[model samples]
Target: MTETFQISPEQAEMYEAKYVPAIFAQWAPLLLDAAHVTTGQRVLDVACGTGILARSAADRVGPSGAVTGLDLNEGMLTVARRLAPDVEWRHGDAADLPFEPDSYDAVLCQSGLMFFPDPDQTLREMRRVCRPGGTVGVQVYASLGSQPAYGPWVELVARHAGPEATRLLSTYWAHGDLDELGRRFDTAGLVVEDVHTRLGTVRWASADEMVQVEIEGSPLIDRISDAQYTAIRNESRELLGEYRTDTGLQAPIGAHLVIARQR
Candidate 1:
């Protein structure tokens, strides 16, 4: 059977309600600030999952500026629409964006490029939609080596939940090379600009809750067996014990913030 990567409504709901606020929301302002987005500037957020960045961009741009969010998954778009009904949310792919050239003042993608099938095409599309001197920004997770907690998680998952489960969960850290990222921007004809390395923190209620929501909201749901889950859960409980804090499990998540100008 073909592996399923897209998420369902239930998974989207879980991700938006739990994972987004805890992890993804912190990086939105970084992209906006780097892009130097101002009021009355039209912006497009590509692969806008649940509109976290789109909602932030909407607020930053004010009512005068337009904000449109595009995503390949209907489930994610559904959650995004519900969050910002006023903001335009469209269903579309990143590689083949349905927009005219020189259409927007700024184009942004947050933690979305790593998931696209053809990131070069996606970057070119992001550049194409942006006008001359317009801004385009991309955000993706840092290397797995930097995040020590994830290394163990992957190992534990491999030992319990299977290697495919580990691979599915490791997708976020796919685009970790800064040099390669800059090359993509250059290849897309976007002018080189500032690149920022940001450290963000994600604090969850507990390790159990963290892994529970991840397993539920992730594409690994149907792929893993119940026995595997039990094993992983038992093993993870012991493994993640070190990460627990007095308040919650506080983990440092690093991201690369790249800002490019459309030429």
Candidate 2:
């Protein structure tokens, strides 16, 4: 079943301040490289949370290249605009992008595709905005089977929240498997050119730090009451203790970056 999508100002700011930094550090470079952003290309960043990838694309494109970041949350776009005033930030949805067909030279989405209620429709929107031969790159987290840092969180949420939690915890979209991505590309009238994985570690100073990050930014927290939230926190702390190392509290995070071209 598809869950409703809503991003309030508080939720958006909480996510930007609490979780986006680490995520940006992890995926921005890989996404930029995959998109092959150049000096004079027009680019669009869909679901551009906190404008990490969008801002990075703006820098890559320089003054000549134009970057437009579209997101449903005004709070996120507010932060994005302040962070990268040079780039245009617009309020829009992934399923219905507010741009003309063949408007961009490349489109980039980092860690955002999985959250769309209609992944296929979102891809179609991305495809519509891309000029023929232009690239559309998507970055999504791989399965929890490979990402230990996220698995424990998923387990805790599922235990407390029930089956619907799968929609929140899993990639929901066809991001983890190449065949699935290929099929999505074909359905969206695009050609899948490359599929690659990147390995990264999300480091927290301690379990407490990680817990605070999730509590403030995660949808799991939004769904739970104060009591359940406390219980989940305690349980997460207990589970995360095993991964603590001298450098810091580090855990493996993996993502798949897929590049497709408009056919």
Best by TM-score: 1
Model 2 lDDT at residue 161: 73
User: Which lDDT tens digits does candidate 1 get at residues 95-183?
Assistant: 88889999999999998887787889989999999999999998899877676677777778777766777677877888888888888
**Which digits, one per residue and each the tens of the lDDT, describe model 2 over residues 1-263?**
23446666677777777567655556887888887888988999998877888888888888888999998877788777777888899988889899999999998898888778788998998999999999999988777656666766777767877766656555532377667767887899888888888877777878778777655555666777888767777788788887789976876777888999988
Q: Hey, what RMSD does candidate 1 come out at? A: 3.1
Candidate 2 clash pair list: none
Clashing pairs in 1: none
TM-score of model number 2: 0.83
On lDDT, the leading prediction is 1
Model 2 misplaced regions, further than 4 Å: 1-14, 152-168, 171-174, 209-239, 245-248
Per-structure clash totals for the candidates: 0, 0
